[model samples]
Target chain A: MIGAERVGAAAAEPSEAIRLEGVRKAFGGDEVLRGIDLSVATHEVICLIGASGSGKSTMLRCVNLLEPVDGGRILLWGEDITSPAVDVNAVRRQIGIVFQSFNLFPHMSVLRNVTLAPIRVLRMSRREADVRADELLGRFGLADKRDDYPDRLSGGQQQRVAIVRALAMQPRIMLLDEVTSALDPELVAEVLNVIRELAQAGMTMLIATHEMGFARDIASRVCFLDQGVILEQGPPQRIFTEPREERTRRFLQSIIEAGRM
Target chain B: MLGGGRAVVVSTVSTIVFFGLIAAAFLFAPGSAQVRQEFFNLHDMKVALVGDPSHGVFSVGEAFLRNIEMFLIGEVLILALALLIAVVRQLRGPVFFPLRLVAIAYTDFFRGVPLILVIYTIGFGIPALGLRVVSTQSAEVYGLAALVLSYSAYVSEVYRAGIESVHESQTAAARSLGLSQWQALRFVVLPQAVRRVIPPLLNDFISLQKDTALVAILGTVIEANRAAQIYSSYAFNYSSFVLAALMFLVLTVPLARFTDHLIARDRRRRQAGGGR
Candidate 1:
């Protein structure tokens, strides 16, 4: 199944969207991402699954250039974004990232939050940005919340607004770092539904998620990270079902026992 | 649980008793009568407040206008200058090292020296230079400049604290959406940071308002404090000083209360889990 999926992926999109080659990152003395190499094709939805502190979010952050890599290079659409000459702001423009905590600008209304990057970074006129933001917000069932502050919204609503804010940039790819993790259990489904809608719309995404079931349903490929490396990866069907790495099985067992899957 | 009405009654009674005892202690103290005669004379206070200008006594009320003018101008300059310094200090990388160094030195020098010394230096020392443009400025200008310089250092630190208090994740989120560092600071980080620090900023402004009195040391400014000093010396009574103190309290007490209100609102907002 993994082999067939790769063959089809290559045929559909001949170019890679994001490629990480031996990416390494450390915070203080702790090396979070020892060496990671992964390639994501256009329109591909790759889910990174791992335990806490396994460097899933770090990998996503490094891809977005939010965290500078200690070693190696990251290429976005065949251009080496990690090169010294590459402008980080310009590089970040092509990729949008939604965070776990939904770090919306608390001081801004939802419309302003969504329109900020489009106006400032993209240089879109305020009116144009507002129209784009409104469309995105309306699509995500957040149209009524356009003038509301993030604090006025529910956790799920804020996360959805965050997604709309990222989408307003019209980024080539989106990185979701446990976007639903901060939501209440009841609120989680609303945020997850938004991601599912994005997936259906064929938005290229690299998602760091704890939802094993969601990963099995939405991801083209699932990468299980262990101790700062991609320990195992395959089509989600194969990775979730087959006996491969003992660590992967143990991780799955714990999730199953915890009734999360 | 204490009943609501009973709790209010208890607190009101306790407050009155607490203050009444302190008042009685001062009233019955040795030489209280002498102190009252000198400092609390209603006639002297009225004379100082409604000054007999024909008799060469500057009205404390009229002279207080100068303090207000100094405070208004100095407060505006200090806010602008301090924010600039705070933003400069926030600049990163090797290229900004020199600018950052200058900002650090400025805050250190001003904060280390007393405000009065700065006033003395800027007021007298600048005139000594005999530089045509600067030397010709009024005593009020020199005094106001000193207040701005000194208070800016303290207020810049407050702004810096606000900037630093904003979580790093806010910056990350902004940057990831393709905002430059400055754009992030201007739009995302600063608005939240400034909102968070407003209570403290108002607290600093209250101090700045009171410190406006310090300009009287220039001798030529003739602000409320100077007027009070002159009146006290002439009448051999300190009641004029009490009137000056009341003037300061009239301005600062409301400001202090406003600051408290801001702090309470901020606390309530946070406790209610984030709102404007």
Candidate 2:
């Protein structure tokens, strides 16, 4: 099963940055992801939109090799990251992920938070890491907050710092897992603006978000996940206006009813 | 402001009256004079504390320097060793199963045994083995080893609790940044864990300071309690023991207060919604 999937993926998309074929994940007896198959091309931004507990986060975690898949394989730029021998830390270095809650190191200053991975994992010199971190923080409008701890920053500032921290690693692909969900309504736009800027810069990204408007505005393709599988996927205009699957329509209708869009 | 001032006045008056009544009752007791002569005699206290060298009497105040030395050395060793054990126990994967079991057994065995028994076993039993260098060590050294081994077990549990209290998301955040497991623990988890458990760590140190008295059980090591015992037997008065108790209080009371201050500051920080 794995071999056939690999051949098919290789033949179909030579430039694909990430591909998941028949990926499955279970927490104990409860299956969160059941046979997920998707491919994201380089420099494309694909957004996964679904209800809570629909395995969106788990799917992203699997692609990052944070969650070990129960079955099937995950390929990163044609490399099989799901293999038991693959070093998870090396795989994660290439794929940067921003979480729903900004999990900044509370004990560290913002500059240290952004520079830590480069200094520690990448073996960059302290001065080099600091220069890179400073540039990223400046780009994100957090230059003045470098010495401040996470607890001292507003929700928006903290999330922006988290994004810059991820970006500092110079990752090939970025995964954003509901990065703005924990922010205030007013603060969401600042974070969304950083992501929009990243997308415009042509950084390949896979995002799982609840902001329908933001997803519709930023996504190159929209994927509707239901019951741990991609129920429907297409260009944003068609998927948002005329979803083919009933579950997709229902999920969109509920999102609209809740006035998220 | 008026109500607050009135409340303070009432509390102050009540505290004085409550203690004054107790003092009067104790003063009028049938054996109060005898008790005072035995335990609060100023001349005997001065003699025990400063030493009547002309009379060949040992000074408990001078001997307390040994307790402080033992406490200082034992404290440093316990912190390093307990943290090592705690980290070992936290190691994952099947390959570490044997090491994890050893850490668990070490803590369980040392914590379960009486400290005094541990002191006796190390001081006498090891010397009885008749090894060349090991058996020739002083009773003070053996007693110190026993304290270090026993206290490390308790302190390691405290360290473990602190490590567990850190949210799992913190580890996930560190790992997702491509840090190795050991790197994540060393740079991220441990700093935060050690911060959160400082108050409890200080509390344990206070106990350790007092427990240094147990070393005198080796019969030849002249720590404060042993010196007190000698002076009491020779002078036929208990004032020397009171002097020794005061010496311990001088060191431990300040530490206890410092721990309370740390706990209060931590509570305030949490209530302020900071340091999440």
lDDT of each: 0.91, 0.92
Docking class of 1: medium
Candidate 2's C-alpha runs over 4 A off are: A1-14, B53-56
lDDT of 1 by residue, A1-261 (tens): 212343455556646889999999999999999899999988899999999999999999999988889998999988999988999999888898999999998888999999999999989999999887888888889999999988899999999999988888877789999998888999999998988988876778999999999999999999999989999999999999994999999999999999999
lDDT of 2 by residue, B68-155 (tens): 9999999999999999999999998899999999999999999999999999999999999999999999999999999999999999
The segments of candidate 1 whose C-alpha lies over 4 angstroms from its true place after superposition are A1-14, B1-37
Please state the i-RMS of candidate 1.
1.8
The local lDDT score (0 to 100) that residue A224 gets in candidate 1 is 96
Task: Tell me how many residue pairs clash in candidate 2.
Answer: 0
Model 2 clashing residue pairs (backbone) = none
* Highest-scoring model, TM-score: 2
* Candidate 2 TM-score versus the reference: 0.96
